[model samples]
Each structure stands twice: as structure tokens, then as C-alpha cells.
Target: MQKQAKYIFLITFLIAGLVSQAQVKQDTLKREVEVTKAYTPTISDANKLNSMPEIDEEEADKPTFNYNIKSQPVFSTFSVTPLKAATIETTPPIQKGYGLVRAGLGTYYKPYGEIFFNNLNSKNTVFGIHAMHLSSFGDVKLKGGDKVDAPFMNNEVELFLKHTIQQSILSVDLTLNHDAFNYYGYPEDPVPAPLLEDEQSINYFGTKQAFTKGGVHIDLDDPGAEMDEEEFGFQLDYYYFGTKTEQRENFANLTFNMRRPLTSGVGLLDAGVEFAQVSNITLPADTAIGKTSSTILFAKPAWYIGDEKANVTLGLNAWFILQTDEETQAKLAPRINANWAPVEEILKIYAGIDGAFQHNHYSKIAYENPFVKPDHHLKNSMQQFRLYGGFDGKMSKRTTYKISGEYAINTDKPLYFMNENYYFDAAYNPAPLIVDNTFDVMYDDMNRLKLNAEILYASSKKMDLSLSVNYYSYKMDKQEEAWNLPTWDATLALGYKVTEQLSVSADIYLIGDRKALIIEESGSLIPEDLPIRKSFTLDPAFDLNLKGNYQLTNKFSVFAQLNNFGFQQYERWFGYPVQSFNALAGISYAF
Candidate 1:
């Protein structure tokens, strides 16, 4: 078998080399012809100028004329329009289309086990599979995990379609996901213990609870016990816009666009309304534990005042949201933005007051409590308002800067993870502890402040650099409970155009330390101190392209490409690795 495989590989390599050579020869011939034609000259004046003569004072002094009629070659009397290159009749290439198919197989390694399992160790040799298809119509992507004990099966499928009409456009999207895979404990193993004291204990044998100290032994014979959860959804959008042109006007827009140009040098006018709906189906522990559906309707009308060099936008928005089996919340939001362009093309400044209200059933304790009676009940509503302002613009041809700040207010009862009843003392007071879930007029509001800044600089041909910093702090009514959370992220990208056909790039990302502080209500001397954890990661990548045409005949040619080099590991989330490095070189024959 090994000998046979070697022979096959050799044959494939030879074929690819032959094809590449042929393509290069054809491309050379074509380029040579283009160069020669570009330098070729017309012969119309050669004979006429020669016949007109060399030392005649009258001819030298007077304007030269082509008196040699034969040299003119009897030019056509009828006028002729040059034939254009047929315009190619190319489509927009389908903004979201697909034309290529990619598939790769690789190895993955990661540390895994129970969250706090002592046997946690890194596992290698995990297989990885990736498949992608892109075309002018749509795209498809598929990936799978390689090893056992992986978090989930990691499957996702999405579809998108767009259609255009005379003055309207429509888009549709669909997605399906199934990402629930975890370890199942054995009968002799201890049941998983609750992370929180008030949480109920679960049996170890059941797939729902994988870890526990002690529990009644239950048979793990159920077939559905190990099944993973599934979720899916779909979305659609339709947009329509029309325009009317007027003399001297800069531009006119008719749509749900909030900004419109004016005939005068003044700023623009903006107004629009947006509606969105989402439905999620969740099955936890093989049971329909949670499901949420919501619809939101909102509209914003804004105006840009002042000249183009300086302007301000004042807008108002109102939102109403309704959740199935949950509460209905409403909000009125407002925004203000200012823009200053000191140097029309070089520098600009911007600032704004962007505020919004968020209301949802999950903000209430009744909806958060999993063990509550009539699980879907309206209990309380939490409202959050944010005021933000920012400025972003170019500092030079290759540098840009952005700075922003935000202040937020969170009102109503504290947002707790578990149901409210679980936190109450059922033994001391049984009658379903009832308390108004309202923000205390005196001191129940939560205040948060955040400041952020980013800078990007690019060199003429080789390097791109970026840096950013974020600072956040929360001030609640309780002083000791208040905490500060700050995060800093930075990245640098460098690309070298080694040659006309080969290029390479290096990218690095850094994340600063992040700490989460939580105060538990334990009837003890003081709250237990939990250790803060930090994580770091690094990744890098490269690409190569060899493009040309190979002539099979005078009327036929083949084009090929050698793409994606080094196949480095790229990941956006922890524990989830992306496709491995692989080469995709294919040839297409054109006639």
C-alpha cells in the first residue's frame, strides 16, 4: 500500500508541474504581444513627409501638408465608430456569492476535563475537518471536532439570499446550530456539586448533572441521556428607497436613511424606523427548560444642524418589546452627535450622546429562576440607559485615532442568575417572599463608566499597527461590592510583498489581565475570596499566489492558482480551534 501511494503522489506532482509550465509559457507569449502592440506606430506620415522635401524655403516656412495622395491609402469616406471591447457584461460578482470550494483535514490539541477536575490535561492528535463553499449565489461552511470529550459536536449551517427590484431589495437568512456536548459521569463517580450553595443537588448518573459528591444511584440506561441540545432560527429583511434629483443639490436620498444631503451648504437630515424579531428554542438536559421569543419595534428621526464643516445630530427613538411567556417592556431613547471638520479633507472631530433603554424578561427574577412555578411569568423589569460620546478621524494619510467614553445607569432589582425564591429563606418564611422589584428611590441604581481609545498606523508598503485600551468601573449602592474591570487589547499586522506573486504577513494580538469579583451573601465572618484567573493566546499566518495562463492551443488556455501557505492555527474563541493550514491549487480551462 505504501508503494502504491508513493507512485500515485509522484504522478500527481508531475502532472501539476507540466500544467504550471504550460501556463507560464502562454502568459509570456501574451504579454510579449501586448508590449509589441503598445509600441507599434502608424505609417500614415512616412511617405508624405519624405515626398514634401528637404530644403525648400516655402515648404519649410509654410505649414506642412501631405501632398502625396497615394500615401493616404484611400481613407474611407464614411465615418466609423470604434468598436468598444464589448463591455464584458460582467455582473457585480454577487456581493455575497460563492464560487470556490475548500476542504481541509488537520490535527488539534487542547486541554480538557471537568472545570475543576484534577486530571485535567492537554490532549493531542485530535482530528479536524473543514469544508466551505462560496459562489455568486451563496455560501456554506462546515467543521467538526476531532477528539472525544470535546465541548460539543460544533455544527453550524447558514444561508443567505438577496434580490433586487426596481426600487427595492430583499434579503433572507437562515441558520441552524447544534453545540452541546459534555462528559457523562459514571455510576460510581460522585455527582456534580452545585457551584452555588442554594442550588439543588443533582444525581451523578443522569446526563444533566455530570458532577456531584453523593446521590442515589440511578441506572444510566436511558438512550436520550447523552444527546446534545439543538437550536435554530431564520431572519428576513426588505428595504426600499427612491430618489428625486434637483438642480444645485449635492445629493438626495429617499429611504429609511437617517441622513440626507441638502441643496444648501448646511448639513443633512436623517430619519428612519427599524423593526426586528427573534425566536430561540433551547433544550437543556433533554427537556424543554428554556425558550424565548421577542419582537422589537423602534424608530429614530434625527437632523444634522450647522454647516458641513461643523454639525450636530439630535434624534429621538422609542422602542416597544414583547416577549412570549414573559413581560412587555417599553423605552424611549434619544441621541445627540456633533461633528467638526476643521480641515475638510484632513481632520475631523465628533462627539455624541447616544442613549438607549433595554428591557427583557430575563432581567426579572421570576424568569431567571429555573425552579419557579409557572416558569414563564412576568415578575420584574430592568432598564439600562447609556450615554456615550466619541470622536474618530484620520490624523494623516496612514494614521487614525478614535476615543470614546460612556456612562450608564442600571435601575431596578439586581440582576441575579438564579430564581429569586432560591435566594430566600424558605424555612424561616414559607409564604412565597413577596417584594416589589423596583429600584430604590434612595440608592438602588448601578452606575458604570467606561473610557476607550484606539490608534492605527500603516507604513507605505510593509507594516500595519494598532493599539487600544479600555477602562471600566461600576459603582453600586454598596461600597464594598463596587469593583473596577479593565481590559486592554492590542494587535499588530505586517505584510511584505516579496514579489509580484508571493506575499507574507504576520499578526499578533495581546489581551490584558481581567479579574471578576463577586461578593457572596454567606452568614459567616466575611465573604470568601476567590482567586482571579488570567489567560493569554498567540497566533500567526501566511499566503502565496502563483497566477498565469497555460496555452493548450491558439484558442484555448488554462488558469491556475496555488493558494494558502503554512496553514497556521487560527482561533477566535478559547478551546475552539479553526481549520488547519492546507493548500488548494486548481486549474480552470477557458475557451
Candidate 2:
């Protein structure tokens, strides 16, 4: 068996060696062959998959190996970018100082000063004090080239306090005013004075037109601006007005108003009432004339409908006006107002018909024209009816315009005229002076038609412009012409900023001619429609004003103003000529 295995192994080894040799010889030998056809390569079609793939559910064995990483900082040549930090909020802005002082001196011996004091930001309370003074002590050149002393002084002081309680606001105001002006008006042609009474004196006519006033006003309001709430308001006002001659007037008013919303706040019901009194206050108990006190009452009830885009107000005003002569005058008038905006923010139309009743208080007349005195009794004025229509709209992005017309029927319209002097000083209880150059007012029934147009433009940051024009036509019931009332008036104003620290402004004013009475005699029978007195037209008046301001520092500024630079000798009244070509320069300081 051993001998046979050895022989088989030997045979196998010999065969293997012979095969290897044969293969090497065949591969190493080079041979050439001729081909009848060229060789080509081709691929057979692949098998298609018809059924979708299915995932196996059988568990598979997972490898279990554990390794630990050494904690070390790896070295790298690449750079890393940093992230941005979070933001931080800043504080609120600082408030301005609470005091301002202004002082100036001007031509015509004018001295002007103003001061304001107020508290800084407060949570629930605000208080302020203001004082002002202006005066002119110089001569005015009349139309006939004559100079007269036309001195005037004005002073004002006011104090105000306001407080907030929950959602309501309460306010209180105290005001005082003292003013004086000399009645230096005289006709161009001097007229002869009639014989004086036993106790009359010419020097008394030189007394200044001086008056003093003090007032207190209080108000409480609940706007009810949030969440369909009711509104309520109250107002109380009282004042004392007096002249230098111990003649005085006292007035008091109390008002209450309430509003109730209806129909989900789409409409409102408004109701209010006012109680007022006017009394003549005189010392010594003997200078008083007629009734001392007069009462006035007003009841206002209205309904308001619609929203900001369109609205209508229907109301009635019941008035009870009493005269100083113990006469009662009562009237009930209708009030209606309708407003609509056809093109929101672009055009708005408003129309209204209303009437009002008010007392011709001595204080009101004195404030309107300090040079005028009353010749008749102080009565009540009534606007029987007033119809007005207007349209206001934005002309452009920075411009706005308004056009309006009004027609009114007025009774006891106050009109001023040159005093018809018959030297009737004896008729007055107090020894008085009589001057024909002085002015007096009368009451007349008038029908008036007025047309007005106004335009405004603003650049917000730099420039501003404004213009207004008015024309009036009057039909008087008893007078030959509307006395001392102009038929046309116009104003133009422009403001420009040259730089951040400098600004300039200009203004021009125009007034048309007015009529004056040219009567030679006077009597108690006045305000008649008869054409006994002749009439003449006064010259038109024009005025131009310029102003400049320069800011030197944040809290300091300088200002200069020029008034009546045209220097035209025209009268605002029949014979009174205003001062000409006045200039003022001043400095303002804030702290």
C-alpha cells in the first residue's frame, strides 16, 4: 500500500509539472492568424422585476463593540467664524425744560414781554402759569398829517391746572386781563364844540379807555372713547369785567351735557342745558341803570347719526334771552347739519341751517372795539336763520382748500359809527365829556351774504403757506350803509426755513373800503331808514409784515419782527389811524 501511494504521488507531480510547462510554452510563443470576419461585442437583455419590494420582519443580529474617545483638543489649520451678540434696549428720550422767557422793545415806544412756567412730565397732574405784557406809548400821524397821542397798554396773566381721575379729566383756569387805550381819534377837519353843561369839562374826554377783567373757568369731561360708553360733561364759567369809571359787568354760566349711544353706537342722543346770568355791578348803589340782573337759558337736544365718513345732526335750540330792561324774549329755532365725503380724504361737503341767541354784553363790545361806546341799550342779538354750505378738500399731498358761503338774517347786529355829538352831556347823570371824534354802536336788522375761500400748503419740514379771501354783501334795515364794515378782506402768509437754525416769514393783509355817516346833527330818533344823512367811503387799507428767527443755541433764540411796513395812512375805523412802520427785536431763553 505504501509503495502504490508513492508511485501515485510521483505520477501526479510529474503530470502537474508537465501541464505548467506546456501552458508557459503556449503563452510565450508568438503566432499570427488571419480572420475572415471582424469581431463584434453584444449584450443580452436584463431580467425585469414585476413584484414590488417587501421588507423582512426577521430579527438580525447586531454587532456589540464598545470604544472610548480620549478628551483632547484637536489641532486644525482652518479658521472658525464668530456669531453676533444679542441686542440691548435703550432708554426713553429726555424731556424739555419747563420755563421760557421772552422780552423785546419796539418802535412807537412799545415794550413787550412774556413769560411761561410749567411743570415737567407728571403722571396725573399738570399745572402752568403764563404772563404777558404789551404797550405802545407814542404819537400816531393822522391822515391830515397831524400827530396825536395814541398810547395803549395790555397785560394778561393766566393760571391753569388739570388733573386726571381714572378715565375722566378735570380742568380749572384763572385769567386776568387789564388794558388801556386813549381815545385820540379826531376828524381831519376840526369841528367846533357846542356849549358845555354846568358840570361838564373838556379834560374828561382825555380819559383813557381802560378796562379790567378777571375770570374763572372749570370743566369736567368724560370722553368715553373706549368700548361703547356714555359721555358726560360739565362746564362752569364766571367773570367780572369793569371799566375805569367804576362801571362794571358780571357774568356767570353753567352748562351740563350728556350723550347716550343707540343701535350699537351707530347713533347718539345728545342733550344739554345752559343757565346764564349777566348783571351790572356798580358801587355806591346809585350809578346802576335799569334792571341789575338779566337771565338767559338755553336747551339743546340733538340726534347724531352715522360715522366719520358721513354724518347728520338734527337738533332744536330753545332760548330765553332777557334784556336789561326787564323784557323777556323767547324763541325756538331749528338746527340741522349734514356732512358727507364722496371721495374719502379728498373731498368733503357740509351744509347746515342754524340759529343762535346771545346777549350783547358790554365785555364783548369792549373787546371788539375799545374805541367804541354804546349809545343804545345793551340788548340781545338773534340770528333768525343762518344757512351755510361749504366744501373742503385736499388739493394735493401737501395742500388743502376750502370754499364756503353763508346767508344770514340777523336782528340787532352791532354796528359802529362816528358819534353823533349834539353836546348832550347833561343827559348823563355822571358829568361826562363829549367828543365827536369818538365812536358809538347801534343795532340794526341786517341781511348778510358772505363768500369765503381759504387755502393752505405745508411741506411739513420746511415751508408753509396760507391764503384767505372774503367778500360780504349787506342789506341794512335802518342804516344807509353798513357803517365801518368792510366789504372785502384778504390775507396771504408764507413761511420758509433757510437752514436748520434760521427761519423767515411774511404776511400781507388787504381790506376794502367802508362807509361812514356824514351827519351834521343828532337826536334820539336814530337808526331810521330815511336817507337824511349822507355817506362817504373811507380809503382801503393794506398792511405788510415780516419776521425772522435765528436759533443761536439749543435753548436760546433771537427774533425780529416788522409790522405795517407799508406805512400807508389808512384807518381801521372812521378816524382812527393805526401806528405805522413798527419793528420789534427780541431774544428768547428756555431753561
Candidate 3:
């Protein structure tokens, strides 16, 4: 009886609620109709008679049926005024402009400062400065019996400046850069044992070791060793070829570009010229030991078509390079690149061809000879060419795939000697042995082919994943001295958004079978004798962003970067040990 009563009660309550809802809806509709009628005009007899006097008799006779149709007036007491036809004068489309300036000062294990500036006006310009000071000193172990003591130092500065200008149909850019590095050591010391070992070993694969013999090793507590080495060496050791070495380099570049619209369906025509200069100064043991300079001039003309949806460009480039105290070379290079969209906007295919001839002087520093008296001025020149093509497309809203392949070749030319009859006899000989023309010495040539493919999936809200694979093969011309260094590299990353304010990311990189052969001038090639230094590394980082009304803050972040995480001590070359697990953590804030 009670249950039945409860059921009846619930049914009655639901019915009453529905009835109330229906009454409210009907009242709202009635109010809207009444408001509409209040502003409508009624067709009274007087108004009809007045309107009829102006109508023609034929029109009146055609509508003689006793029918009455009325509609509400569109304008009421609270109505907006009718707008006049406005002559909208649009300001001619002014191009957008933007600028950015950023500066950062941080103390890592060392002190670091950075400044960056960018201008996005009619012309784009960018400039940056980076300076760092290390508070602690480190040691750089060398081969043979030499060692270099690198004390924790300060006052290291590097600067870069760039400017770009854009006109209606032309653009110009310029860049300047300077770099300086400081290291501590003494002159006349035997090459460090570690470095000497590296020089002698065919492959770098081993643990790092320190050499204990040969040069004078001064204790850090020695008052003389603590003085600024540059000034101390210049003042004290003015006779024995000085006691330190310093290197400085200056670089500058300029580029000019012009574009012209074409009448045909083809894209615009483009031409450009580039100039670059590099000056390297090396001071050793008190005096300027060597200086090398290089200058290059290059020009390119190209034709381009289509838009971002699809594009094809063909171009030819020519360059002339001249090096001080070296031979000059002229090169002609051509390039072609294209992107095709076959199905409107779904799939994209791309291909490119690049080829160039490069020539440069062999470094005499490696042989410890002065610039004026190079052991052998080797005319080392090569022709390099590559062809690459790829396809990228979306399979769905959340998945994408890309695949590419490249083939490159490097071929050497005949050698030319500056001195025809130079011979090798002394340790510091300025010439190489002149052998008979029939003496067949195989030059170095390489052919490489690479293939890469990647797939990205972002189907979930909280997680995104990507997988990629790369394959490479390097082949040499001389069979006995040839090397087949086939490598496969892969990477995987996973990220988690812990909260709106913080996130963490972890990634791993794996390399496989990074082995090769090392050949010597003695006509003997060592195989598998060099260490195959391949390993997997992990990088995990976290970031926190604390929001404020008019400021942003990140309190603390940590990163653990592990190289050769497997703890395998192998070197890409002999005697030089690769870095082990190195980790750093810091906190940053900005206003």
C-alpha cells in the first residue's frame, strides 16, 4: 500500500512539472506575438480609401477579392535607424612589422650570458651575442707526453651580428661574427701522452688515461702558474719562442637577391649573389705563427613556379674561390627542387638535386709547419653530388608519414704540387718526396646512400608518439683500403603533461654498428682494429611554468643527460675517450 502511494505521488509531481513548463512556453510565445501586433498598422476604411485614390483602376480591379493580409512593422519605438550606404575606404594594406629583443643571464656550473634581437620589418634582421665564463678549471689530456691544464676561467666572449633589408622586389643581408677561446698550457712540452696515443691509434675506442711524463708539470699552488698566462708568457718568456698559443677568427658574409614577376603561369624569376671572407690568425709561443684567409664569390639564377601547395624550382650557380698562399678554383653547380601535390591538398612529393666542386688547402698546422713553409701544398679537390627525394602525406587527422632517400658521391682529382722537386728528409721539411709520375697512389673517394622514414601519431589527447628509422652505407674506391661504415640510427620520445603548469619529456637515441677501417700512409689498412663506438643515450627533462598577472616564472627544472649510458668506453678514434654520463640542473626566472 505504501509503495503504491509513493508511485502515485511521483507521477503526480512529474505531471504538474510538465504542465507548468508548457504554460511558461505558451506565455512567452503569446507575449512575442502581442509585441509584434502592437507595432503593426491596421487597414481601416479611411486608410484604404486614401491609398486607393493613388492606385490605378486596373490594379484595383485585379485585387477585388475580399482578402485581408497583414504583417508587423519591422521598425518599432525601440528600433535602430536605417544605415546609409557607407563608402568603406580601406587603408591600403600596410605590411605587418615586428621586432623582438631577448637577453638572458644564467649561472650554470659556469656563468653564461646571451642577447638576441630580431626585426621583421620590410627587411628581416637578426643579431645575437653569447658570452660565457667558467668558474672552474678542467684538464685536456693530449697524446704522447703533453698535457694541457685548463683552469676554471672567466671573461670569454662571442658575438654575432646580422642585418637584412627588403625592398619591393629585392633583399640584402650581411653577417659578422667573432669568436675567442682560452686554454692554459706551456710551450715546448712534448705532446700529451693521451693525444699522442690518439694520433697513433687507428681507431678511438677506449677509456681515457693521463700521461705522467715529458713536459714540466707545475703544481696549481705555484704562484707563477696562477698568473694570467697570456700576459705572463709574453713578458717572461720573450726569448724561447714564447709559452702559449692563441687562435682568433673573423668571418663576414653578404648576400643580395632580386626577384621579378613572370607573365607566364610560372612563378617569379630569382637571382642572387653571395660574398664571404674568413681570416684565421694563430699566435704561438709569443709570435704570430700563421695566418690564413679565404674569399668566395657566388651567384645563382633560378626559375620558380607554383605556390606552397606545390612548387618547382630550377637553378644554376657558379662560384669562384681564392685562398691566400694557395691555388684558386672555379666551380659550377646546378640544383633542382620540386614539390608536387597530386590530390589537391592530401599528398605531397618532393625531390632535389645538388652538386658542387670544392677545393681547399691542406692544413699545415696538423703537420706543425709554418704557413710560409708548408710541408706539401696539396691540391686537394673533389666533386660532390647528391640526389634526394621524399614523400610526405597525411593518412588521417592524427597520423602522418614521411620517407626520403639520398645518394651522394665524392670523387678526387689529380694532385698538383707547388714545388715540383720537393723531398722529405728532415722532421720539419718544407716539401714532400717527389715520386715518379708512374707511382700509383690511390686517392680517397667515397659514395654514400641513405634512406630515412618516419611515422607520427597523435591520436590521444595526453600522449603523442613518433618513430623513425635511418639507414646509411658509405663505400670507398680502393678495395684494400676501403671502408663499409653502415649505420642505423633511431630515436623515441615520450612526453606527459602532468598539469597545466608543468610537463616532462624523455627521449632516447640509439646508434648501431658504427665501425670502420682506418688506413695509413704505409699502404697498410687496419680492419676492425678501431673501436666501434655505438651506444644509446637518454635525455629526460622537466619544465614548470608558474603564471602571474603580468609576469611568468619557472622555479626549478632538472635534466639528466646520459651519453654512452651503457657505460661502454669506446672512442671514435684511438686514445680519445667519449664523454660518460653528464648531468646538469638549474633554476631560471624572468620578469
Question: Rank by lDDT, descending?
Answer: 2, 3, 1
Index of the highest-lDDT prediction: 2
lDDT of 3: 0.34
lDDT of all predictions, in order shown?
A: 0.31, 0.60, 0.34
Give stretches of model 3 more than 4 Å off. Answer: 1-250, 265-293, 307-310, 324-328, 357-384, 412-443, 457-461, 464-468, 479-486, 515-564, 572-574
* Residue 524 CA displacement from its true place in model 2, Å: 15
On TM-score, the leading prediction is 2
lDDT of 3 by residue, 1-591 (tens): 565445445434533432332211100010011110111111111001001111221211101111111010111111111211101111122232221112222222333222222232322333333333223233444332344443332332333323221111111122222222222221122432332243333111121211111111110111221111110100000000111123223333333323334443232221222222222343222335455556665545555766767777887655556666645555656678999888644578999987765533322221121211222223334456789999977776656677999888867532111111233445434543221111112246767688887765542334445666677776767543222232555655443444433433343444444332222233225654542322222122111111111112231122222223344433222222222332322222211
558 Cα displacement, candidate 3 (Å): 5.8
After superposition, which runs of candidate 2 have C-alpha atoms over 4 Å from their true positions? Answer: 1-95, 191-205, 223-229, 264-291, 374-376, 421-435, 522-532
Give the TM-scores of the predictions, in the order they appear. 0.44, 0.76, 0.48
lDDT of 2 by residue, 1-591 (tens): 565445445434533432332211001001111111111111000100001111112211111111011000111111111111111101111234666677778888888787767664676776778788888888887665656778888888999776666656677889999988776676554422432233324433345668899999887764434323455556778888878755667788876554556563322222233333334432123545433556765656666777778888887766655544444656667889999999987899999999887666667766666666522236568988999999988877667778999999989888776544444456554533234565556779989898988776655456667777888899999887878777887767666767766777676777777787655553447666442365768877787777776767666667777777787756766667778777877877666
Candidate ordering by TM-score (highest first): 2, 3, 1
What number of clashing residue pairs does each candidate have, in the order they appear?
17, 0, 25
